[model samples]
Target: MSHWLPASPCTPPGCAVHAGPARRPVPAAALLLAGCALTLAGVLCAPLALSLTGGARRERLVRCWAHAVLRVFGVGVRITGPPAVRGGAAGGRAGTPGVLVVANHVSWLDIPLVAAVCPGRMLAKSDIRRWPVLGPLAALGGTLFVERERLRSLPATVRSLASALHGGARVVVFPEGSTWCGRGPGGRFRPAAFQAAIDAGAAVQPLRIRYLGGPPDHRAPAGAAAFVGDDPLAASLWRVVRAAGLTAEIRVLAPIPAGAVPGRRELARLAQSTVASDSANLPAASVHH
Candidate 1:
């Protein structure tokens, strides 16, 4: 609701519950074990859903599992802009093709956060496709896997993404290549995703995700992985929710018309600049991904 960025690295005083070097309200080992259990369940159930039903029903199940994971972590989302389209209708375009929704990368949490809110297929790195439990669930979620180093695979990846969009499925992509804290200016967004959008002649919807307020004890420091490994998931998430209530602003800027932007590079720059500028004004704990 509020957009002010709070001062970072501030120690909250007089809060007896959180007052010590070890401020984790929940034990880290237990939280991780729960996460692992949830992930395993998701992986096991996904295939059954896919085999029994096709199309929208399966997508809905994926979304449900994603939300379940988020809930297990005690995260709540506050979305701005129109409700995400169900059954890949492109925000209500009927049989018309769906738009390509591109966002910035923030943390590992971005996967569930975006998946829970947006109903669509995600283009993720190949490594995520190979993760033990999470990878299988993501695959069953209809994620498109891409190889970052294999340029030869780029055309096929683009075509696959385009086909999904053309088939009335919104494709979500993190064009920033990897996650960042979103503390300063945003990271450089890769142009490949924009290229996919252009190839499909689909409009590009730029989404800026800002995670406002995190646990006082969690040290987000610098580096990308710190946000995930430096703090316990449940404790960190609860701290954020207690302070900011898992509040996030999903700003859907005006869609850029297909072919209006000269090239993928230019389009990428435009979208990156838009998100970076908007997110810069959000809370410090807030990150755009």
Candidate 2:
């Protein structure tokens, strides 16, 4: 086991209160089991609720599940800017037509993190649709799956996304194409999906998700999938939950008018720059054990 001291009592310029080192009292095995059980139960229940209910009720159930998972894992999430707006007056009436959100790729938790806050449909990789438990759960949540290898299918995917936007359903896309762990930027943003926002004439909302602590060196532990690897889902999650409290700064950058940029590339660039700039300013969370 490792011993960590509270951040030095002396305050420094531009420094936030440092969190004391957390000790894992509960047995890792036990915590893992409990977390896995809760996650599986939640995943199983979500699909049934979606099938029986329509409209906001179904979404609320999913959001509840997301919150439940976070609570069970003892994770904390903090948002920095405005809350997300859903369709119509119920979602704070940002507008009825709905908005398209573009966010950076980080961990798999990004799904539930955004879902818990915004309550929007997600655009996920085709592989997720085939996962054991999560696949079905996400499908029930109305997540849009895209095949990255099939360039020909891109148009159809964009059209579906556009239609969803016009129908008053909020949609989220991670344009980084893949996930990465090192400091600085990871993958380049893929512009194809931005076409959906332009075609639908919807405002493009940019969001940035940054993890404060959790693995190897405390950086956003690789991507969520890798972090969860061969270990039981519950165990992997507990490792993160016990490692450190996670702080996510979700900034809703000013809405960019659809088609304001002549092409998807321009839209992607603008969104990427906005997210990168905002992430750079957040306080660094300790990764060293």
Question: What lDDT does each candidate get?
Answer: 0.62, 0.62
User: Which ten contiguous residues of candidate 1 have the minimum total lDDT?
Assistant: 1-10
Model 2, 113-165: lDDT tens digits are: 77766778888879888876678777877889987667677788989988888
Give candidate 1 misplaced runs (Cα > 4 Å): 1-28, 51-60, 85-95, 214-249, 285-289
After TM-score superposition, the amount by which residue 142's alpha carbon in candidate 2 deviates from its true location, in angstroms, is: 1.2
What TM-score quantifies how close candidate 2 is to the native fold?
0.75
TM-score (all chains, Cα) for each model? 0.73, 0.75
Whole-model lDDT, model 2? 0.62
| Clash-forming residue pairs, model 2 | 217-287, 218-287
- Itemize residue pairs with steric clashes in candidate 1: 5-283, 104-289
Q: Model 1, 1-289: lDDT tens per residue?
A: 1111112221122110222123244554444566668879878877777689766665566667777776555445556766544434534556766778888765666777776667678888787787677788878778999877677787788889888877777899888665555455655777877887787777777787755434545422222111332344444444432332243445666667778788989998988887777666544443322
